[model samples]
Target: MQKIISASNFADIMGVSKATLQKWETNGAFVPSIDPAGRKFFYVEKLLGVPEISDMVQSSWEEEMQVNPLRSYTSIELFAGAGGLALGLEKAGFSHILLNEIDHDACVTLQYNRPEWRVVEQDVRTISFKQFNGKVDFLSGGFPCQAFSYAGKQGGFNDTRGTLFFELARAVKEIQPKVFMGENVKGLAAHDGGRTLETIRNTIAELGYTLIEPRVLKAIFYQVPQKRERLILVAIRNDIADKVQFKWPDPYHRIMTLRDAFFKGELYDTDVPPSEGQTYPLKKQKVMELVPMGGYWRDLPLDVQKEYMGGSFELEGGKTGMARRLSLDEPSLTLTCAPAQKQTERCHPTETRPLTVREYARIQTFPDEWKFAGTLSSQYKQIGNAVPVNLAYAVGRSLIRLFNDIESL
Candidate 1:
């Protein structure tokens, strides 16, 4: 027989507050088992089919926009991954003329939800930008950062050949869009001792674009429920550079919590719907079951800790991710592709397992109805790689401000 966990215990296992659990239950985000004594309990089976609540929130935003519309602009996206950024832009009033993505599954996911979007599935290198030249108002991508070889000279555009950044620059050069935005892991700012980013700046300048001082945007500050960060780089074509002084979007007053993500509260009206999820093996599950809320391997008994940590027990730094459980009081740690991947485990606050697929999507601010394509692992990977939808919406709003200045000029 499966053991039942109380609502508080389950919330502890899932790393959420008891208040959050109660709110979710009240909102119909989740329905736990009720005993004859009127006590709320959660079963392992109940955890299996958590619904995608983020989609419901996003749909509400879409509905709100239809009633109180925003200014419209045209955009072309490169390296589009799973449509997170594109969808956020759409919500902010950007009409995408074309979206290019190399991954088959991601492209399929984009098309599956928004069939009206021009989903161009091809290697970005092979595509010509002549058609969009001088027409697109905005171009955007989350380009991968690669070090320039330098070749014993000042690194220039040619030295960046074979890297995805070059393709991004090539697109900007060809399209001459009024503005372009590029995003990457925050580490890109200091990559290659900052020389890589300097080269990118010079390259953009060579293409007659003025670069903004790149800044790392914190997702938590931008209404995302997780503590993820992305480095953003914006460039304005020389023709429009002086016309607008772009302002990054203001941070929301209240920070969103993991509870807000998975349950029905301030983030959504309806509770998360049931969906599929991954499970831990017997041995791992047994070990995780012993961990208390907000605890990790260090909290385990000494002998068990040594066995679970292996040689890592003697390592220097705190292996925080190892056996780590979340805390309900704070924002969740940055989510990864595999919730249960070794060395990066994201155990639930009160539960003995990793978060479900719907929970993962909610953390990334994906809308509930935005279905992912491919297998479970693929879905996780796609969500992990995406920009948080709300973060993208804030960025889109800022872009709109920038474009408005250009139009004024």
Candidate 2:
């Protein structure tokens, strides 16, 4: 049976504005049927003609999940926060030789969950990966994006010395794994007028690797119930690069929504477990109560909006994130380190309180049994900074396929 989605839901899935859909309808590029209530709806099957949309819905997520590593493959992970990516990659069949993180709480979380993992709690700069040279099959890290001082100068590896990316590149240079991936925020692609990425490309070239064109992977398309995106860069050692081709992971057949997260659905077997969460102050609570589900600051009364937004009220552009109440029917907005902050309020849909720690984890696709460590704030930070687990698993499966191809050759 063909699934039917409202125009707004369709816009959310395709990552386009409602106006664009309207234009497409007028031009006959894409048309929606108007119902008796004057609501426009689109059949999911009809979207197959759109190239980007087809790429996501055409693949079978069930088939992809069946992929398993042909043999034991070893990997090393850097900036391993809360083990979201690590756990997902492990599920995809890669065994970790070392998982490194500098944060005390994050290291504790990793160690607590995976006692067998070699969780190294130290600065990545102080570690030596030379010992793993030519031994490891894969290396990956989500290095925090920082503006390269030597970007556009073509200084290659040595020029990136002080940045966190330098640590990842250093690990790559030292380990020389068959395949390596670097993850970062989606904005990194356009950072400093794209010079930052160009420098990274050159650095990979100097290290004797062939850099594949980087892509921004959306979490929602990979069975994650949040609108998060990560930029991924995968490179293969030049010697093996020509012999094998790396294919990007196919997207899941459907976009997951927040309903799938908190409720007992495809995402979880049980309802969200009770856990500690932040609460709004009395004054803020009153204002938030006025916000309808799926509504933001604009939904508030004029007087309340004036009082709450204060200076931001007068600013240009829609401050959609301000006083935002998440909708149960749609995926959540990209999470921030602090959910209750004035600029990025992540209020519960039915209640006036902020999302709990476990609820936050659910949106990021962390398994319910995966407990976090440290203070409540620390747990939020760890989860917020993580690459969504399902997204990582999809990417990991593709990497495993790349390795399988390399093994056959």
Candidate 3:
């Protein structure tokens, strides 16, 4: 993976001017990430798959235009991983009737945390949601996004049949919640030239719901101290759509930093409590030691940089995460399931080690009291894959407001 090389560095490598590359992006080179100040970053490998779209600019504000929703709302969460979404929604007033997850450890985590809630540890495909049909108010889950089979004409619902999303759609059709939401990586919005999402849209419509255009929500804007982004899709049943207005949650009072997450002051009542974390091997540990807080491989001495990054050093892209250390002032880069991976290193800001279980949870806004089950790696995966608790809480408030309007009408 190329770290985030600058546009100038990339343009030079590609034998093109910066203007020409920007033009390519305008003409559909690939979607890029823009910082708060509008600095853009491109993933060199990902740029190869960028499909041209005349509508590129407009997509940025789509999430901002929509409305967002809900207390006393009965909900079922499918593919629930470690309760990030469920916990937040519960805090906002929705009661969970059932939560289903296939991972045993994740199920344990959920069950251990909330013994009163019904947590079903089973593959979603094997369970029939027909029992809850018309009884649930909200259906929420983060379905794993898989590539659609382009082997035939883009199949809509039927074509989605073997994937996890198919299971999600099946539940939606069976349970028929007043409103349903799904979350996935932001990349899903552009995956496979958008055909996957197109299929999803068609499937939602076929089930008699109005598809709210999905928008990518940046976690940083919602009080999370990590730069994770999730594409959130919400749909309302056609029959009730007109009766309620959905309002997206407003941004948090301020952007949170790793300092807020790791130390006591604002985000937490206390500093990140000491917990188990993974350690780098001696060689990798020594290499990471040279990386200053907030600095990455680029800040390393030239020879050390090359040795540390291996072949990645020769690449134009910075692969910025390599030999990287978090910053106290800025939000941490998006976390990965394993913090110590060479390609996605998330070295602690002042430590030469990977983020600890508690630090990882804090970054994702998980409360100190919440406990994770399973092996250390499994715990990391669950946290890394979650919708940030605070972000979900914000969205949950919007849901409650929407339901308030719906019931009034």
Candidate 4:
């Protein structure tokens, strides 16, 4: 039987106020067991089922996704920014034969960290992947989302020309990999009123690959300590699609907190290593100091809110990100390239400053020793653009499972 904890004790453990816990209970976010004496209590095992708690604990951070038993399987990655996906795949036991990216800084970072990876710094359209036909196991990319020129016809491979996604599909056709994975911002599902994604699905079908129902994986549910989400599209060679079955990774049992990312804890053996970071102007720092942990622009005095928010104060909608300080008690907000940007502030929980570069990397689940190369701004961009390493690991493991099933047949 699982141990039972009192409501107050559970609240303390979660670092949330009792009122907040009650509110969550009221909303059915969590439920507690009742004792015969009328005391409310919760089972730790049951608490793990809560999306916020269970998801974090069971998320991909701690375990290695299953590895392919094959002696060797190669991969080619396109638009491989800062290697978040690549790193996770590597951790899950995939070998990189080639990786292509247009950004010079990202290429430099890749080469700096793993000299073994074949880094092709060039435009995807200009590159020819035909030489690798039937030689690669997987072709993956996080292609940028762009509107397609539908031309009012059934959009297929030809109509997708001029978009980055075309290059991804082109590579899949050229390499003839057993599997291909494409990831993008969640909005891709609804982009252009869903026509764009529908076209992608149809294009993959035309290329003779079986498309799996694409899904949007919320990073938070996958053990990334941020609220980031990505849309994943997978396709398998038609010959073996029926022989293989693919399953998305299970959600973690607990949510990682900001403290888990920064402090010496399960995620890291030691505190974050020292690294360069951007700083706020003196005036901005003073203003931020007044903002408490988990507080945002709304916490500021009326005059301060007006001054800090400028015209945004009068604007409608919840400008929630403004002057937002992360809560140490909870997972951090999704990070952006510019932490101090007014529209998407990610203020440090305790300090009146932006998270350092290493801190940013930690939140993105980058390994501690995985060094980044570039100016501070460039590094921030690299970290911000990376797929959370843990999430990639989960996807990598799933790919391995598919590969194994195919090989066994």
Candidate 5:
């Protein structure tokens, strides 16, 4: 079957620039199949020859969606921001025994949504996990990535001291859950010339767990309408690790777009509800008005581009995020803490303004009913810092499948 995709989406998948894709079409290397709306798209079948792209389009997402835990599985999440991952795990049939966060606003948001949850609001360093030792099935968190000082020869658990990762490792040492997953920005994989990830692997081994091959998952492939990427580190307690294999979740059959996020569609049953959003200054508004949908700073007039980009205009990189307006036909660019910030603008497609709070939530696959607590900026930070709910759900289902296999064994 022929599955159509937009030029930008295809480019992103192919690891080429839109200009490069355009060049290919111009040179007759490959032709795009146009849809009824006169938009260009490529056939999914044609790209199946490429291994990386093939894995994405050939999906078992529907089958994976039916995955359920063999029995009730308990989880304790550290650094739980706004409950995005927690909610996804719950949907995948895991019961949370505890959710910990240091941010007051994020804690309030979690309590507001699920009062029954044991939401612990405090620094993770002060918390004790010994009480839940051997009682939890999973422990998960998105510990902030920090450079480990390789001053000593030992690159084990103690070496990670003073970093947030040390706290996460401490929880694992105490709780000894069957499985634990750590999520972080994709850059974490290559941070500090790969020493950081190496230390993480070594530390997991020291904790008596077998580290699975870590992977970077693209959120767009997991039913989230954003181009965010996260590095996932999953480990199985050594005893259980010997008996079973962990399979990553299948990518969805198709990429969701901002259109699906905003409208009543497969992703959401209702249109994005109105909510507070930031406003651009008069000068900035006028500059953004000239940029077209899916266009960035480069789309502005030559003089405006210089003025808007300032010194960065002469920088070498594409710098595509500046003065950017989202396109309805494509997944949103990864969101940041503030939508109207000059370096990472997320202007609405047709509105000539920043995306509303609800719109930001929608792009991250947050349910319309999941209310965030905080000032407007704090709300945005909580949402922006969160793992996209759908991406987390996909991973959660895979974890459920792993647990089910372990149960059978």
Candidate 6:
């Protein structure tokens, strides 16, 4: 299929400026057809044939292509927001013993989607995982990032008491799973100037688990069509860590885009199914209508720009996300809980509106049949808060491989 790429996206991909692209086209080096509206459309075949583009298209790191679990490995997840991580691991053949989530709507979403799975709808701190000790193969959590209290001691697990992470760390101590992983925003690696991570590292060691130096996994590098990043902290039981080696999941060969998320293409068998979505007010809609696909507020005319960005107009940083439109040919920006938020606008690529609930699900790589149960806002929050399913699947495969190695020995 032909992609009517925005000039900005094309220029960025081809390592040329808009002017340079125009010049190259005039010189007959490479040219794309221009629509009546003056937007450029390029053939995907020609785009991939470029030496620079070809390299990225050729390189692949999808772990499942090479690795498979030896058996039905079991897992339990805490703080399982919307089942993105759970579903991915399920796809990797991990039978979940239990999945815990706090939000009522999210719990319903999970229970509605997977009635057969155990859905614990309570706070993590109140639950005891002792029963599952040494039973589950993996334990995972996308614990919220909260600052630890540095009151009395050198911020160990105690300092993080009352925090959700403490609950995850508690589960690890109680369950003594073979491998435990905690995922959070990339900024966690440097949270509180790295002191927080030091505390987390020390806490994991104290719990008798050895942490593989935490690494941030970019969603776009996997099969996800968003630029979201997660800081993954995977630790192995001290007894087995020495006998096993953990490997990070590899990236997919080519990057996916909004096209893959919304249209019938490689990522989905059919186009996105219509679902509930938010709409902008008349005033906001008019302003957004001026934004070209892939362009942001800065692309608007100066007067409108000044009017639209009253306080932030004089700001130093680009503030590029304001009033932005997504690009069909590029991975979307990290989605926020509210798609229409002022600072982190996630506008649809072709339409001047927020992404639909299904579109948001699609971007996170949730399977088509998995339905979210809640108010529209709740659904968006669940999807936005999720770790992309494809990224989680990639990590799940790596965990399986590591477990396989441990079992072999």
Models 1 onward score TM values of: 0.83, 0.96, 0.83, 0.88, 0.96, 0.87
lDDT of 1 by residue, 1-409 (tens): 1245456545633446667888998999878888898867866555645322222222333323333223467899999999889998888778999999999999999999999999999999999998889889999999988888786466778878899999999998888898999999999988999999989988899889999889888787667888888999999988778767987766554457777887788777767777777889999998888888767888998988999999889989777789888766446788998899879889888778888778888888888999999999999888888999999988887787677677767
Give the per-residue lDDT of model 6 (tens digit) for 1-409. 2234455555555545567888988998777877797767665567776764554455555335667878888899998989999999888778998999989998998999999999999978788888987888889999989888876466787888888888999999899889999999998988899888888987898899999988988787678988788999999998898887888876565567899899998899999999889999999999999999989999999999999999999989878789999989788888999899989999999998999999999999999898887889989999999989999899988888888888788
The per-prediction CA RMSD against the true structure, in angstroms, equals 10.5, 1.7, 8.3, 4.6, 1.6, 4.8
Clashes of each: 22, 0, 18, 13, 0, 1
Candidate 5 lDDT over 1-409, as tens digits, reads: 2376677888866667888999999998778988898888887777777665687766787889889787999999999999889998898889998999999999999999999999999999999999999999999999999999776576888889999999999999999999999999999988998999999998999999999999999898889989999999999999999999999998777778899999998898888888999898899899989999899998999999998888998889988888999999889999999898877889999889999999999998889989999899999999999999998999999999999999999
Candidates 1 and 2 compared: the better one by lDDT is: 2
Model 2 ranges with Cα > 4 A deviation: 19-29, 34-40
Model 6 pairs whose backbones collide: 61-250
| Steric clash count of candidate 5 | 0
By lDDT, the best candidate is: 5
Candidate lDDT values, in order:
0.81, 0.90, 0.81, 0.85, 0.91, 0.85
Please write out the lDDT profile of model 4 over residues 151-240, one tens digit for every residue: 648888987999999999999989999999999999999999999998898899999999999988877656677778899999999998
> Model 3 residue 21 lDDT?
85
- TM-score, prediction 5: 0.96
lDDT of 3 at 176: 88
Give one digit per residue, the lDDT tens place, for model 3 in 1-409.
2245345434433445556888987897645677676767665455543221111222222353243332377999998999999998887778999999999999999999999999999888899999898899999999998987644475578878889998999999999899999999998989888899998888888889998778888776677887788999999999998777777766543457888999998789998999999998998888889888878888989999878777777778657777889877667788888888878889999878999999999999999999999999999999988888988887787788778788777
How many Å off is the CA of 39 in candidate 3?
17
Which candidate do you rate higher for lDDT, 1 or 5?
5
